[model samples]
Target: MEQARRVEADVDSCDPCLSVSHLSLRFGAGCPSCMAPDAALERNVCPVCGTVHAVRDVSFDVYPGEIVGIVGESGSGKSSLMKCIYFDQDASEGDVRALPFDGGAGNILDLSSQHKRRVRNTVFGMVYQNPYLGLRMDFSSLSNIAEQMIASGERRVDAMCERGYELLGEVNIPARRAKDAPALFSGGMQQRVQIAKALSNNPPILLLDEVTTGLDLSVQASVLDLILRIRRDYGVGMVVVSHDLGVIRMLADRTLVMLDGRVVERGLTDQILEDPQHPYTQQLVYSLI
Candidate 1:
C-alpha cells in the first residue's frame, strides 16, 4: 500500500492512462479473500462471518494505446472491477484515478455525482456484455449517440448528428440506418451501435466487458476486428474483460489473471499463454488449448 501511494503521489514519471490502486469491494466486515483465497473462490462466503469479497485489493494500469485484458472464470471479480471503474457500482475501498478529465489528476472513485456523470461522458467509454445496458432500444441510433453528446454539453445539433453518422459508419453500420431504432437492428448490429455510441464522445479510455460473449463466431470476429482497427487508427487505451482466452489472445497486448478477486498473475498476453506461471492460469490456458 505504501509503495502504491508513493507512485500515486509523484505520478510525474508514471502516466498510466488509467491507474487503479488497491481498489476493493467488500460486502461484509472483513475481506474473505484476504484470509483464504481458495476458500473465498470455492465458496464466495467467508467461513467465519459470510462476508462477500467481490473484489480484493485489485491494482493495475492501462497505458496510452494499450489493450489490457482481464480474464478469469465467472465470479472471479473481473466484472466487479469493471462496474467499479465505470462507477455503476462503488468500491468499498480504494481509488480509481484517471486522466484527460477534471484537469487530469483526480480520483474518479471519489468524485461527486455531477463529476461522475462528467467523467462517464467525457473520460470513459464502456461497452457491456448486454447491449441494452449501453443503448436505448426505443431511440434512433443517431439520437442515442446524440444523447451522450448533449450530456457532455455538445449543443450544436448539426455537428452532433454528423459525428453520430460518422461514428456509425466507422463501426460498420450503414449511415442510412442512423434514423432507425436499435430494436429494429440485429443483435450484432445493436452491439456495433453500442460501440459507435461509446466512441461518440471520443473518450481516451474504453472499457469492454464481454462484448462478444453471445454472438455467433463470425459476428464475434467482426467485432474483434473492428476493435483492432479502432486501436490502430485512433491509438486509444482500452481495458477489455472477457472469460474467453481466444478473445484475450486476440486483443490484449497485456493480460491480468484473476482468481478469488485477486490478480494472481499478469504479463504480456503471449507470454501468459505460452508460459503461465500461476497454477490457476496454467489450468485456464490448458483448457483453452
Candidate 2:
C-alpha cells in the first residue's frame, strides 16, 4: 500500500486538540485480582469478578490536521476507546481533555452532564461505524446536518441551511439529493451524509469509527480521499478507527495497534508496517502482505 500523504502541520509545535490518558472501561465492578497493575485476565474478561475490561489504559493524542489511527481486530477495544472519548460510553477511569475546553486543564470525563453535552456539541464530532448511530435515517440529508448545527447553538435558519448545503456538497452529495432521507441513499452516500453532519459544527477533533467498513472498494477510496481532503482544507484533527490496515495505511500518519483491550504497539504508520515489534502486530502486517 502507498504511504499516506504526510500532514503539513508542525505537530510538535502545535498542542494536541485532544488528549486521552489511562482510559479504561469496564462493564462490572472489578475485584482486586483483576484490577491490579499486573493483572492478567482470560481475554478481556475478569474470571474472578466477570468484569469485561473493554478498554485498558489506552491513551493517545491528536494534533491539529493529524490523523491518528487505531487498528485492531474485533473485541480489541478500539471502538470502545472511541466511545469513551466521545462520551457515548462512560469510562471507568481516565482523563480526556479537549484543548479548546478549559485550556485542556480539566478532565472532560468528570464534567457535569450539561458540560459534557456542551463538549460533545462544540468540541468533538463523532461518526460511528453504523450510520444509524450517527445519522437520523428518516431525516433528510440536509436536515441531518441542520440537527447537528442546531445542537451546537446555530440559531439562524438561513445560516444553517447554507452551511448544510455547503457541507453536503463538499462530501459530494448532490444538491438535489441533499433533500432526500439518508435511508434512501446507498451505504456510501449515507456515510458521506453522516460525515457532513459530523462536520456541521466544525469541531476541532473528529472521531471516526470504522467509517468505511462495509463499502465497495471504489466507494471506500472515495470516502478515504474525501477524509484526506477535509483534513487538508479544514485542518481538523482526527482519530480514525478501523480493522483494515490498508485503510489505516492510506490515511494515518501514526498508528496504534490494540489487542485484548490494550495498545500493544504504536509508532509511525510506515514504521509499524515495516518492522512491527509485537507478535500480534507482526501477524497483522503479515496478513496484509
Candidate 3:
C-alpha cells in the first residue's frame, strides 16, 4: 500500500478535499528499465521497452485550502499523476475521490465517460502548461472563458458575458481587451487568461501542470502572485506539478519529491529543503543554491 504522510507542518486539520490512494499507471505490457527495485518485479514491469510506469503507487491528499506540489524532473511522472486526478489519463490501478463529488468515495476512474466530462467541467479545473492547449486562440478571451461557463451548464448570454468580463479583470487582463483573440496577447497575458478560464466555474480543486514552465521572470512572479492570492482569498485546493523547486516552494504548503516515477520523499516545504532525506533531493537542493 502507498503511504500518504502528513509530516510536521501547519496543515489544516479538516478532512481532505481530495484523496488519491495507491494510484499506479503503467504503459505497455513489458517494460525493462532501471526503476525495478530488483529483477523480481512486484508490479512485474520495468521502465524500458514499451512499458513505463508513469506513476507508481502514488498517494496524497489536499485540503480545502491547501496547495500540494509535486516536484520532479521531466519524465518523472509528476504530470501523469496530475492528469490521473483530473481524469486526463486513466490510471492502471488505484482510486481517486474528491469531496463535493456526488459519488463520495467512489473511484472517479470508474465513472462513465459522460460523468467524467461533467466532473472535469464542474468539479475540477485544469490549467495546462500551454495556453494554446487550454485556450482557443482564434476566439476572443471573453469567449474563451464563456465557453467554460457554457460547458458547466450556464445559460443566458448576459450572465455568461458578465462572468467573462469579470474573469478577465480578475486575471489582470485589461477589460478593454476582452474581445481580442488570445493570439494577440503576450505569453504571460495568455497564461493569465488561461487561469481566468480555469476558475470560471469556481471548481473546488485546481490542477496546474507546469504553469510557469516558459515565461519571463517578472511574468512568472506575477502569475505566482495571482495564484497565491486566489488561494488566500478563495480557499481553493490545488495540485501543482513543476520541475522548478523555486516554483514549488513559493506555491506549495507541502511538497512531494519524485524520482523515476516514484515519490522518494514528501514533507513540509521547509523540512524537505533543509533536511533532504534522499540523495537525489540533496543534489537537487544544492543545485538550486
TM-score for each model: 0.91, 0.97, 0.91
Alpha carbon deviation, residue 3, candidate 1 (Å) = 30
In model 2, what is the error at residue 164, expressed in angstroms? 0.9
Shift in Å, residue 118, candidate 1:
0.6
- After TM-score superposition, what is the CA distance of residue 284 in candidate 1 from its true location, in Å? 1.5
Candidate 1, residues 1-289, lDDT tens digits: the string is: 3433343354335478888998988787765444553453444557677788888889998877788899999999999999999999989988788877754577888889998999999989999999889999999999999999999999999999899989999998888889999999988999899999999888999999999998999999999999999988887889999998899988988899998788999977877888899999999899987
In model 1, the Cα lDDT at residue 76 comes to 91
Where is model 3 more than 4 Å wrong at Cα? 1-12, 30-50
Give the range where candidate 1 is weakest over 10 consecutive residues by summed lDDT: 3-12
lDDT of 2 at 75: 99
Clashes of each: 0, 0, 2
Model 2 C-alpha lDDT per residue in residues 1-289, reported as the tens digit of each score: 2344344236777788899999999999999999998898999999999999999998888898899999999999999999899888889999998998788999999999999999999888888889999999998998899899888788998999999999999999999998899999999999999889989988889999999999999999999999999998999999999999999998999999999999999988988998999999999899998
Cand. 1 Cα-lDDT: 0.87
Query: lDDT per model, in order?
Result: 0.87, 0.92, 0.85
Off by more than 4 A, model 2: 1-9
Shift in Å, residue 276, candidate 2: 0.4
